[model samples]
Target chain A: MTIENYVILRNKKLTEKTFELTIDAPELARLSEPGQFCNIKVSGELIPLLRRPFSISQVSGTEVTFMIAVTGTGTGILAKKQTGDELNVLGPLGKGFGIDDTFETAILIAGGIGVAPFPFLINKLKEQGKEIILFNGARNSAELIKLNFENELNSTDDGSAGLKGNVIDLLHANRKLFVNKNVKVFGCGPHPMLKALQDYCSTGNLNCEISVESNMACGFGICQGCPVHSASEDKYYLICKDGPVFNSRDIIL
Target chain B: MSELDFTVKIGNKLTLKNPVMLASGTVGYGNEISEFLDLSEIGAIVTKSISLKPRKGNPPQRVVETTGGMLNAIGLANVGVEKFISEKLPFLEKVNSTLICNIAASSVEEYTECVKILDKYKIIKGFEINVSCPNVKDGGLIFGNNLEAVAGITEKVRVVTEKPVIIKLSPNVSNIAEFAKVAKERGADAVSAINTLVGTAFDIYTRRPKIKNITGGLSGPAIKPVALAKVFEISRNVDIPIIGIGGISKWEDAIEFMIAGASAFQLGTINFVNPKAAKEILEGVKNYCLQNNIKEISGLTGSYEL
Candidate 1:
C-alpha cells in the first residue's frame, strides 16, 4: 500500500446523511479491487487523529469513490470536502472480494451503507459474464441507495421501498428464484443482518463470502487494532491484513 | 549542512544515525511502514513487544481515538521470540536499520531468556524491555510499578546480553525518575521515558467502555507535555541517557524532547497517522539544527533553560 495526496473530483450527496466522494488517484484506483478499502485522513489536525477507513465503493478510470456516512466527526469532515481539496489516502488495502468461477450466479446482499462495495463488485461480476442478483435493504426509502442495476431488489423496514422487510427476509421470500441455481452469496451489512445471512446460507448449504468492518488505527497488519476471531483457530485474524473480506465459514463473524 | 553531525549515541554502545526512532507497537515488525519510506534512513525501528509465547491479544475493539490522542490495549500481541527470530528477523536484517527488539514477559526469567535467545542476532542492536505495557493482565505494569521488580528485571536481562539495554519506563507512576534510577543502578544502558499513560473512554449511548480492555495506554499529541516532563524529571534526577517516547508527532516535538533531556526520541502515535513521519521529522530536525547554527544534534540533549 502507498500514501498519496489525491485531488477530490466530486462530493455528491446521495442522501441526507450519506455522500459519495470521488478522488483522482490513478495508482490507488488501478490497484483497487472490490471489498478492499482506503484509509483517508479527513483533516490535517490531530483532533481527529486516526485516518478513517472507507470501502472502495466504485472505481472508474483514474477516479475512485467512497460511500461515506456522516457517523462521527471524521466522516462529517469528509462529507464537507470540496472538489479541489487534497486528501491524503493510504490504500488498495486488505483482501478484496474473492471472485472465482466456482459458482455461475452471484447473489449480492447489502444492508444500509453496507451497499458500499457492491457497485465495484457488480462491475467485476459483469466482466466474468456471471448472472447477478442484488438484494438491497435499509431502514427507509430515504436511506436506500439506488444503484440502478439490472435484476435489483430493494427492501426497507418501513413499507416505502420494494419489499417491506429486511434484506434477509426479502431473500427468503424470493429464495425459489436462485435456490436451484449454482449460486454464491456475497454479503455486507450490520452484525444482525450478517448473522441472519450466515445462518440462512448455512441452512441452505450455499457458498458465501462476507466483508466485515472494524475501528482500525492502521489499515495494515502492523497496528493489530482490527481483529476478528478465526472460526477454526484459537488466534485472531487482523481485519486489515487477514481480511476485510473473508469466506463466511472461515470467520466466526 | 553535510558536515553537520546527525548521529546520537544511546548509551555507551549504540550510536544512531539520527534521533528519530519508531516506537514499539507502532511500526510492528517494520515491513508495512517500509513501503512508505526508507527505514534505513531513520535512527532505529523498535519492534513490537515480543514474549516467550505468542499472545492472542485482547478481543475486538482494541483501539479508540480520544480528543487529541488514542487509547490502545493491544495486550502486547506478538509472534513470540521463536517466531521473531525465524519469521521477522530476516526481513529486518535486510532493512539495514538499527533494530531494538522490545521484550515483554510475565516473569524476570522470561525476560532474560528472551534476551538470551535474541542476543546472538547481529542485526539486533539493542533491547527495549517493555515493563510499562498497561494492556495485559500479566507482566507489564506489575514489573514496572515496583522499583525492585524493575531493578531485578534490568539486572537479570543485563546478565544475558552485552548489547545496550534500554528500560522503557511507565508514566503511570508517582515518581517516574525513581524507576529510571533503579534501571540505571541495575546496569541498564539507557532509559526510554514515558510509555503511554493509562486512560479510558466510554460510549454514553451504550453505557459501556469503548474498548474491550476497558483501559488502554494513551498516546498522541495530548501526552507530549507529560512525556517531556517525565524525560526532564528523569534527566534531572538520574544520570542515565533518556530516549523519549509518548506523543512525539513532529520535528518540533522531537526537538523539545531532546532539549528536555532525551538523547533520542521515538515517534509513536504519529506513525499510524503519517507513515512517513520518521523520514519527514529527520529532515525537519536537520534543517532546525542548520538554521540554529548547532554543529551536532546530540548537543540539544538536556539543553533546557529554566
Candidate 2:
C-alpha cells in the first residue's frame, strides 16, 4: 500500500448529494482492485482527524475515482474540492472482489451509495468475458446514480424510477433471468439492504460476494477499528484487513 | 555540518536511536505500517497488548471519530504471547528495530507469566506494562487505578527479567504523579505517562454510545494538552525516565513533550491518518534540533522553564 498526495482531476456532482472525485494516483490506480478502498485525509486540520475510507469506485489509466456522499464533515470537505486539489490517499487496501470464479454471468446489486464499487467490478468482469447484469436502487429518482451499465435495472422506493420498491425486491422480481445459469451475485450498500440480500442469496443458494461498510479509523489492520463477524470462526474479521469485501457465505452479514 | 546525536536512553538499559516510538495498539505486530515505511528507521515499535491467551477483542463499532481525536475500545485484541513469540517475533526480528513488548493481563500472575514467557526472546529490548487500558472489563484500569496493584505488578514483573520495565500509566487517575512515583519505587526503569483518558460519544438520534463498549480511551490532538500536563506533573514529582504518549501527532508535539519532561514520545492516533508519521516527525524533529543548535535531543527533556 502507498500513501501519497494525488491531485484531483475532477469532482463532478453525480446527484444532489453524491459526487465522483477523480485523483491522479498512478501507483494506487495500478495497485487497486474492484472491491478495494482508499483512506482519504479530507482536510489538513484535525477536526475530522481520521482518514475516511472510500471504495475505489473506478480507475482509468493513471487516475482513481471515489464515489462520495456528503454524509458528514469528512465527505463535506471532499465535496468542495476543485480540480488540481491534492488529496492524501492511502490505498489500495483490503481484499478486493473475487472475479476469477467459474461463473459465466456476473449479477451486480447496488443500494444507493452502495453503487460505488460496481463500476470497477463491471470493468473487471467484462475483461474476464463474463455477462453483466446490474440492479441499482435508491430511495427516489433524485438519489439514484446512473453509471450507464450494459444491462442496467434501476429501482426506487417511491416508484419514480425503473421499478418500485428496493433493489432486493427488484432482483426477486427478475430471478428468472439467472435461474439454472452459472451466475454469481455481487452486492454493496447499507447494512439492512445487504442483510436482506444475504438472506435472499442464501435461500436461493446463489453464489454471492458483498462489499461491506463500517466506521473505520485506519484502513489497515493496525487500528483494529472495523470488524465484521466471521461466519466460519468465533472471531471477528477486520474489515480493513480481512476484508471490506467477503463471500456472503463466509461472513455473518 | 556537525553530527547531531538523536539517540536517547530510556531507563538505564535501553537506548533508542531516536526519541520517536510507535505506540502500542496503534501499530499491530509491525506488519501493516511496515508496508508504508521502513520499520528499522523508527526508534522503537511497541507490540499490541499481549495476554496469556488470544482475546477476541470487543464487538463491532469498536472505534469512532471524535472532535480532533478518536475513541477506541479494542479490548486488548491480540494473538497471545505464545503466538507473538512463534509467529509475530520472526517478522519483527527481521525489521531490526528496538522492540518493546506491551503486556496486559487480568492478574499479577498473568502479567508475570507473560513476561517470563517473552523474556527469553533476545530481540525484545524492554517491556511496557499496559495496566491502563480502560476498555477491558477485568484487568486493565483495575490495576492502573490502584497504587498497590500497580506496584505489585511492576515489582513482580521486574523480578522475572533484567529488561527495562516501563509502566504505562493512565490519565484517568486522580493524581498521575503518585502512580508514576509508585512505579519507580517498585523498580520500574521508566514510566510512559498518560496512556489515554476515558471518554465516550453518543449518537443522539439512536440514543446509544458510539462504541459498543460504551466508553473508550480517547487519543489524538485532543488529548495532547492533557498528556503534556500529566508528563510535567510526573517529571516534577517522580525520578523515573518518562516515555510520553497520548496523541502526539507531529514533531512540534514531540518536542513539546520533551520540553514538558519526556525523554521519548510515541505517535498514537496519527499513525492511522499518516502511516509515514514517524518518518515525517523524525525529520521535523531533527531539523528542529539543528535549527536550535541542540546537540543532544535528551537535553530537551524536562527543560521546561516554568
- Per-prediction DockQ scores? 0.89, 0.90
Give the chain B TM-score achieved by candidate 1: 0.99
**Candidate 1 error regions (>4 Å):** none
Each candidate: fraction of true contacts kept? Answer: 0.88, 0.92
lDDT of each: 0.93, 0.93
Residue lDDT tens for model 2, A22-129? 998889988999999999999888888999999999999998999999999889999999998999898899999999989999999999999999889999999999
Judged by DockQ cut-offs, the docking class of candidate 2 is high
Give per-residue lDDT, candidate 2, residue B169: 96
Instruction: Give one digit per residue, the lDDT tens place, for model 1 in B101-139.
Output: 999999999999999999999999999999999998988
- For candidate 1, give the docking quality class from DockQ: high
True contacts kept of 2: 0.92
The prediction achieving the highest DockQ against the true structure is: 2
Which 10 consecutive residues of model 2 chain A have the lowest summed lDDT? A172-181
Q: Listing candidates in order, what is each one's chain A TM-score?
A: 0.98, 0.99
